[model samples]
Target: AQSVTQLDSHVSVSEGTPVLLRCNYSSSYSPSLFWYVQHPNKGLQLLLKYTSAATLVKGINGFEAEFKKSETSFHLTKPSAHMSDAAEYFCVVNPGTYKYIFGTGTRLKVLA
Candidate 1:
């Protein structure tokens, strides 16, 4: 079985500052992890993914994550934050099954 846990329910950052959102997971085998962002009243958009390839994965808008199998973690980070980045982010895990386990989600609040 595989599951995802978003460590933070909410994260606030000022414009042009760095942003960090933590995530953890558990799986019986190698799992495919992904990040998705949902804007207000909009659909979810794929950010990045890790499927046993490179540990370091880059996404749109300068966001990136590193897969640490030893730590069972895949935390998202960005060098600078933007106002448009404010939204709900989710950590998902697919364990070679048809089911995709999604986290509770972390709402990012970018302040001016």
Candidate 2:
């Protein structure tokens, strides 16, 4: 079937290091992909997205991702992760360019 898979359910990192949260997806259509960050007790915020126009996309808080059709992946990456980056991140896909179907979830841990 069609779905998004975040390779790691959780990622731990030091406060001032790079962060890598892997996400891979598959769809019959050219999909709409997104990364959303949710802080504790807060709603989801759009971090970045790939809408087929651009392969490399960037979003808030110095995060970016590349849409690779060959690899069937769109992984979230950030240089020098902040202490505030300790939050859950979700990989979302829209098969019809409508609303999103999100992955289960990915929890991020920031260690001082």
What does candidate 2's lDDT look like per residue over 9-102, in tens digits?
9899998899999999989888999999999999999999898887999999999999999999999999999999999999999988556789
Residue pairs clashing in model 1 are none
The sequence of per-residue lDDT tens digits that candidate 1 reaches over residues 36-99 is 9999999999999999999999999899999999999999999999999999999999988988
Residue range with the least summed lDDT across 10 consecutive positions in model 2: 96-105
- Local lDDT at 14 for model 1: 98
After superposition, the stretches of candidate 1 with alpha carbons farther than 4 Å from their true spots are none
Q: CA RMSD for every model?
A: 0.6, 1.0
Relative to the true structure, candidate 2 reaches a TM of 0.95
